[model samples]
Target: GITLSGGQRQRLAIARALAVDPRILILDDATASVDATTEARIRLGLREAMKGRTTLIIAHRLSTIALADEIVVLDDGRIAARGTHDDLLETSVVYRDIYEHGLLERQFADAVEARGGRQPLEAAS
Candidate 1:
C-alpha cells in the first residue's frame, strides 16, 4: 500500500470503518485535514458507499458538513441547534458563525483568484 498523508489517513479510516458493513458510521471531524478538492472527492465516494448505511458526521468545517442530511450544532456541551443548512443558518448563531467563516474563506479564495492568482499580500503596497 502507498504511504498516506494525515488527510489521506483520515479518509482511509472512514473507508475502513465503512468496510465493516456497518449499519451506522460516526465520523468525528473526519475531513478536518483534507483540502476542499480532496474532501469533495471523499464525500462523493461516501455518498455511494453510504446508500444503505447511516452516517453521523462531526465537523467544524461547515463546507464539508453542509452535505449532511441534517446538522446538529453543539455549544458548551449542549445541543445549540439541529436542522438542515438553511434552517440552522436561520436559527442558530453558532452554526451561522461556522458557516460564515467558511463562506468568507471561499470568498477570499475567489477574490485572490480574481486577481490573476496573485495574493494580495504579494502585491506591492
Candidate 2:
C-alpha cells in the first residue's frame, strides 16, 4: 500500500475509471480532493473520455457543476430548480448570487499558483 495525497488519490481513482472503460460512470464529488486548477484539467480530459457515456457527476465546485448537460440545484436537500447552468443562472436568483460569491474562483487561482502557472487576480473592492 502507498500513502497518497488527497489530490493524487483522486487522480488515481479517475485513472482507474478510465482504464476499465465503463459505459456509465457516476462521480460524486470526484474532484473535491484536488485543487481547482487540477480539477479543471482532469475534467477537461474527462469530457472526451466520457463522451457518449452516461456520467452522473455530483460536485459543489461551480467549475465542475457547469460541465453538466443538465443541472439540478438543490437547497436543503430539496430540489430548488433544474436546468442547464445558463438557465439556472438566468431563472434562479439564489443560484446566481451563490455563483457570484462562490470560492471556486479563488480556489482556481490558488491551484494555478500551485502549478506555477498564472497568478490569481487581486480581489475586487
| Tens-digit lDDT string for candidate 2 (7-122) | 89889988998899999998888899997679889989988988989998888777887868898888889999888889999999868877886766776867777867755555
| Alpha-carbon TM-score of each model against the true structure | 0.82, 0.79
List the pairs of residues colliding in candidate 1: none
Model 1 per-residue lDDT tens digits across residues 1-125:
79889997997898789888899888888888997789888878877877887888888887667767888889999999999999999999999998888888888888888889877669576
lDDT of 1 at 40: 86
| Every candidate's lDDT | 0.84, 0.83
Superposed by TM-score, candidate 1 places the C-alpha of residue 60 at a distance from the truth, in angstroms, of 1.1
Candidate number with greatest lDDT: 1
Clashes in each model (backbone N, CA, C under 3 Å)? Answer: 0, 0
